[model samples]
Target: MSKKENAAPTTHTSESLFGKVNYTWMLIGLAVIALGLLLMAGGNSSDPAVFDQKEVYSSTRITIAPLLILAGLAIEVVAIFKKPKA
Candidate 1:
């Protein structure tokens, strides 16, 4: 046999790091995180002298926003670790 005939053929396959579903989940998580950040922002008073304790310490900003952020982070972790479908 010739040297060329003895050599094995090489095949190339292209693949993505993340699947469609994984990307979708990642997007959802990002949206949730953005929402949390938006909720956490904007406690500024119109007047420099006036400080609104209620607005600054609202339950939504203090409690819900952090929870949403944490939940989004957890979702992101799950998405990253999830197995892609063959």
Candidate 2:
């Protein structure tokens, strides 16, 4: 009985660093970033001499892609800093 009284307290912790919500947000951010990067790709002309200004300067690639990337980054930051509710 004395030995039990003197024993150290038990502390159980999760193996993962972040909770499920954080991981979910991280995954969403990664997907959004991937989509942005994919949108920024393509528009390559086979002939180097000939350039297609319209394809390279499309609204989706120039505007939407960057916005998506920024949104993803914001989400990632939020996910990293967000605390799990008790």
Candidate 3:
């Protein structure tokens, strides 16, 4: 007996811009969020003595917030631009 060939395309449709494989981009977003939270919380906390608002002002918050925001934005862009897959 001969085997019948399939008619439908085996490949799936592309949903986003890059592709479904680009899911890792979302992880980056999560990492950024965690990092920002950590940094904001860390706030130059070298020793577990105490946490002061003044210290927070001079803490990594300066670095963390921007990084998190930027990373979040980038992830969003990737998610939007990337395609689902073929």
Best by TM-score: 1
lDDT tens digits, residues 1-86, model 2? Answer: 79889999999985767889999999999999999999989556778897778888889988999999999999999999999665
TM-score of each: 0.81, 0.74, 0.51
Clashing pairs for model 2 are: none
The TM-score of predicted model 2 comes to: 0.74
Report the lDDT tens digits of candidate 1 across residue range 1-86. Answer: 99999999989798988999999999999999999999999556788798788888999999999999999999999899998999
Candidate 3, 36-56: lDDT as tens digits: 777776534676687666677
Q: Which regions in candidate 2 have their CA more than 4 angstroms from the true location?
A: 1-15, 43-49
- Which of 1 and 3 is the better model by lDDT? 1
How many residue pairs clash per model? 0, 0, 12
Using lDDT, give the best candidate's number.
1
Q: On lDDT, who's better, 1 or 2?
A: 1
> Clashing pairs in model 1?
none
lDDT of each: 0.92, 0.89, 0.69
When 2 and 3 are scored with lDDT, the better candidate is: 2
